[model samples]
Target chain A: MIYFKKVLKKIISPYRIAGSLFSSQYALMLEYRAEIVLWAISGVLPLIMLGLWTGAEARVLAGITKEDITRYFISAFIVRQFTAVWVMVSFEEDHIEGKLSPFILQPIYPFWRYFFSHVAEQFTRIPFVLVIMIFLFIGFPQTFFIPSNKELIAAIIAIFSAFCVRFILHWTFAMVNFWTERASAIERVLMIPYLFLSGLVAPIETFPESVRAFALLTPYPYLLSFPAKILSGANVNLLQGFLCLFLWGSLFMFISFYAWRNGLKQYSSMGA
Target chain B: MAIITVKDLRKNFRVSVKRPGLSGSLKNFFNRKTILVEAVKGVTFKVSQGEMVGFIGPNGAGKTTTLKMLCGLVHPSGGELLVAGHKPQSRNTSFLKDITLVMGQKQQLIWDLPPLDSFYVNAAVYGLNKQEASKRIDELAAMLELNDELVRPVRKLSLGQRMKAELLAALLHRPSILFLDEPTLGLDVNAQSKVREFLSKYNKRYGATILLTSHYMADITSLCSRVLLIHQGSLFHDGSLDELTLKLSPYRAVRIELKEPQPKGLFVNYGQLEEFNGCLVRLLIPRETLTDSITSILNNFPVKDLEVCDPPVEELIGNLFKNPNY
Candidate 1:
């Protein structure tokens, strides 16, 4: 319990560490402003899908409305923005290049360091994302309705739970580096399903019924689409969505813990 | 009581030997040859508090393997090792607080950040409050002449300044014991001497026990009072540097500067000529014959200058490992 308390204190007092991490990341982002602008421009797939879905609703195919389309794609965009992580690339590079040993030697756990850095990255990217969102609101004034106060509350909850679910999943995959010499193969295989089923490119509503059923049972939808549904005010079953996200989060957390404990037994700290 | 102890410490590594050529590589994918290399074979040593010991070994001699085991970075396959009254393999916070490892080849500094920032990170990780950490940082910087360099990004600093920062980062916790592996691998003579001076002073001031391993014998000769020489996963010799020198190569050298170049091999009767320059020839004579050989060389050749010296630590240590009974 004392150890836990100490770890908590260090993590929560991020002013000592997180400030530098945020500043450094901000500096890096500023240095690459042109690249960031290019990335934001390329993330127009959601708007493209919005055009198709709104057209379908206008023609009365299954009675989809403009409000629902706005709510769905906007929620998808927000969820997609948060759940995506680059931890796999960082972990694979550190493992292959032998930078992992220094972390092993340090008194602090490596997991927490990665966690703080990821949070810092998210915090730094939020401003740029807000700028893009404001531009979208100005350009597409008639396309999507603004989120109400109640929908805003739901969006917050969904984003929180979505991050919890995705963080554990990425944590579990990062541990796979211990068993395999190279984990890039796992990254390649996981990306396809994650991008599709998680609703980063398109809402799960766009999938056929059979695929939608399978996506619901899997953990990927909770990571992006569920929160997106909430934020867009698409009238999701709030209790059911929370329970599904919670279950996947708990399961991934368990897998992450198990993998970390067992994989440590096999770790060699190569070339230390 | 021993501050650090090890009994039957053993570490084995399974390395896969991949075959070369297209067909052999294809065959290896289905079934590859794996070899078990006994990196450290049941080695044992102990150090009391405040004893600076040098760990010397050949390239594949398992010196680093043993060091990693001591630091808890790698778990031993078999052995009981304790550092600062704690099992290092457990990597307990208390144990980590009391010990530090400085690998000269690997640095802990953030490359893009100033050394001071890296020092601050270390301070946070070690649980040092800002005020206390600052005091120690200033002291270390002063001792290492890093006041000006600490503000510069570590990437811009020379290797020696960067190494000094690495040392300071390792010492911020004021660990009771330190493990230094190749602490002066790449440095100019002045930088190496400065590092040696700081290490010696730090050890003296703190009474911090150190077990330093290095390929450079000067690192051992200057900083380590006792030495442990290892070869091929076993202890070849463990005693004082002087004792090893005396036991392995009991010969003193007599260097003579002839008025002119002597015949190609005329000095065989005196002793074995170790080295020859234009006019200076160095001979290795048995310890008992040192006085007589110097006298004989002075009388025979037109010797302008002569001086007697002991064989270097490297030659003494090399011979000991090369010939076990030497």
Candidate 2:
């Protein structure tokens, strides 16, 4: 479509702008190589959880084994690293610094630039981190397994939707910048849901029936648990997953738009 | 027709001032105090196409507030403003496509990547074809002397280099109008002159209208024939430099080297005589009385040497705002 081409052109037209973003990201990674290694070390949470879960399976529970635990946790680890929400950090920084005005003046929409840079960084992360997981899967074949083509296709779609859901939700939270001077405190409190409900540390199914039902109704589960579940051959209805994703994505889309519109109304240019 | 017009433009902000101290901070948890500050108060102006107008004021004088309004970066509390036939506050895509705002403190360059990368991204955002965007970039870079710096990371470049790159990025689309806010800030004297020269050349070359705000008088004197002086969010003076000078302080300064030392009382009534030594005195005279004052001085004393010139424009602008009708 012409509209799509126009959007694409805008994204690439400022080649230097786009190039700078990628270069900055790569350079940042280089500068913080040690920090990244430390972060990778903190990913020990999943391994710890794997040990706890495997120890409890004196007899196999839901066909889960030491192998299953390792594979599932590693997959969770890989997903968690890849899907980290940087949009919130940059948005909050710009909002607080009063730098958002310059972005608003540009001929192109700021949202697309933000979206593209984040997506581009993800491509970079694949080589730096995702491939490491791929090799891990190769070494631990008993626990980790690749999905079939049909499931892989479905999971890919699910991952993309999940990414959208994550971006929108994080953006919605970042929009809190308009109302409050310090949004990280608010974001920190809000991040509890992603941890408990999104199956980051444990599967959502393991929760009590009542809590599980509530978690399913929220957007957090779609962001993390859905794709991993599909890849693991979990018995989830394809149509139902698609509908759930659509509903959550639409809900966030609505929230982000409203917040952006309202936020713009109160955007005062700071200083002289 | 006016490319930019503003009427009764006003912008006010309600800022929350957090109370200090542990007890005061605790009280702020339940109740907070807010104050309203008017940044731009009922100022108005009109800029036609191809005009290079300077907007100058003291720090916190709201020069930037008006510039931001024209660029559609901030909405005004009360005003009517149209840039390129579009209401700036609406910031419609079409309106944005035709106008560019370059702020010296803020930049669009990707800090870690070559400025060209940012240019490419802007190209995509503007929907320019590869060839067309590159052609424009090449032209702008060449004009800005940015050929070597274009491919280097922005952070690696000097402040002057970064500014040149920023200008190139903003101009890639060749917008019909430019709103430049302190575009030459922090550059060394040589770089400042280069930037001013490029801006003047660009304005003439493309016939691009420019509305620039800066504390740098040199930038105004070199690049803008017409300047708008703002004070306390209001338009204090809006006219060409010549008109401003003639209207504000139509006076000439007279300097004389006396043949012998003279007492101060003799010259005090004529004007404020600034004497570096007993034999040298400088007198300010109204423009109409310059000839009479010189003749009187010559008749009274043996004038060794003499010179007369108008007061600097900056002094006149300062006087105009201090006493509006003066």
Candidate 3:
């Protein structure tokens, strides 16, 4: 009777299942604290861009001042840390090494397992990223603007949504491993556009009008630059940002689902 | 009733042909060539409830592929398949709950964490309540003698210990059907026997249907009475082990020990000489002529002791594989 009750409870509450997955993965991530810190430190590209853009002659690019560039790049760095997704490497390894077989046999879908694990990793990374943010604020007191309570809530929501957008998009890309062994190579190709257009290197607004238009058309701007603009207290149309995120997130979700269904058909699970 | 059924199941893989040299590689990259390799070619079989069946085959004989197809890991290119009354390729959650598949080469446990942590994760995935999950884990861990090892990281445990933990993780939900692919591979004799004993006990206790594939004959000889022989993606024979032995091996071995030293030539007339020690002789005699030859040897020779037995199970299987007609 107790067993039947437990099964009944499980059928009703999938959030509990996700919560358990999140907890286990969170514990596992905590075991790799040094790696998390190293990864947080590795998002230094925006900081480098900050240095380059704030020079005396480079202060006013596209009607933006040195202080504005500093805030934009710093916010970009923080956003990048939150939105990072490395599930592609994990998927490629699991597929190549035959580690995916066991996951396939489980009653739960593998997508939720991977999703919770990545989310746990991001959760583990938050404190380390917070420390970096504090140091950056202490170093550049004049450039940073303390967001209002309303702005803070909006920024949190936007950043989290951006993380979802990035996660779903990359997860869709990772599904390419189902058909080809060179998925990491393809990821490297995808990273080029993400680096330039997502505001990891420079704010998309600094680019010319034509380039900015193209960047907005792609999903890359919604991932990091749009959220970074929100965190920097820049003027952003909330409705437009929400619309872009919802559309792109749903599109990527569909692609991932379709790829996963087709990939299972083609998956050989080659190695033991 | 059949718990698992497969009919004309087929799986073919498309493999790209690579050229030898750099220029050939360039040309081949531009104009690719692919060939269809059939891993499982119209194989068919049925496993009834509460039956422990051994699936034996040579390397590349599609044993693993067949197991994968039945477990819903790999989709069959053609044919109908069912497990626990559901089409395996459908991969319904209810079907998944009723079945479990364990591969010796693969693991479901998280490598960096303790097996207990993985157990909890699996418990949640399978929807077992905390109390029931702990109860199941404790019971299985005790049966597999994994009390002290469950808390250690999986990588810290030896292969045998880890394999035991893997089994516990797989069986936590008490699946009614199990698909085991080389579950005893790469274990020492003691560990192998322990695993076999645990599996035997688990099967008896739960009345689960097991279809196990293994290269080791001991695993089959001990746990499975019914054996399925597969070769070249075909089921050649399916019956009791005794039946297979009788049909495939038509000869028995006879040994004679003399009170005094015996000449090697003395046993030549009785049967084909297999071994000739100083005071003992061994011969291979046809099953039909076994009693006559034994009587003649007893009456003619100064035999102090005599014994007759069938050939080793490994030797019989080897011979069976060698001859495709059988």
**Worst window of 10 by summed lDDT in candidate 2 chain B:** B317-326
| Rank ordering of all candidates by TM-score, starting from the highest | 3, 2, 1
If the candidates were sorted by their lDDT against the true structure, best first, what order would they fall in?
3, 1, 2
- State candidate 1's TM-score: 0.87
Tens digits of per-residue lDDT, candidate 2, B1-326, equal 78888999999988777867998897887888889989898998888899999998887788888888888888789979988989988888888888898888887787777887778767766667668988999888888887778887789999999999989888888888999999988989989988999999899999999999987889988888889888888887898777777877666788889898888778876776655478989887777777888889899988899998778878876765677553
* Displacement of the residue B83 alpha carbon in candidate 1, Å: 0.9
For each candidate, what TM-score against the reference? 0.87, 0.90, 0.94
Q: Candidate 2 regions off by >4 Å?
A: A1-44, A57-68, A134-141, B18-30, B246-250, B274-277, B315-326
Regions of model 1 farther than 4 Å from truth: A1-45, A51-63, B256-282, B288-306, B316-326
Question: How many steric overlaps does candidate 1 have?
Answer: 2
- Candidate with better TM-score, 1 vs 2: 2
Task: Give the local distance difference test score of model 2.
Answer: 0.77
Candidate 2 residue B79 C-alpha distance from true site, Å: 1.3
Q: Cα lDDT for residue B248, model 3?
A: 73
Candidate 3 regions exceeding 4 Å error are A1-12, A56-61, B19-32, B259-271, B276-280, B322-326
* Order of candidate numbers by DockQ, starting with the best: 3, 2, 1
Please provide TM-scores computed only on chain A for all of the candidate models, following their numbering: 0.82, 0.80, 0.92
What's the C-alpha lDDT at position B23 in model 2? 86
Task: Go through the candidates in order and give the C-alpha RMSD of each one to the true structure.
Answer: 3.9, 3.6, 2.5
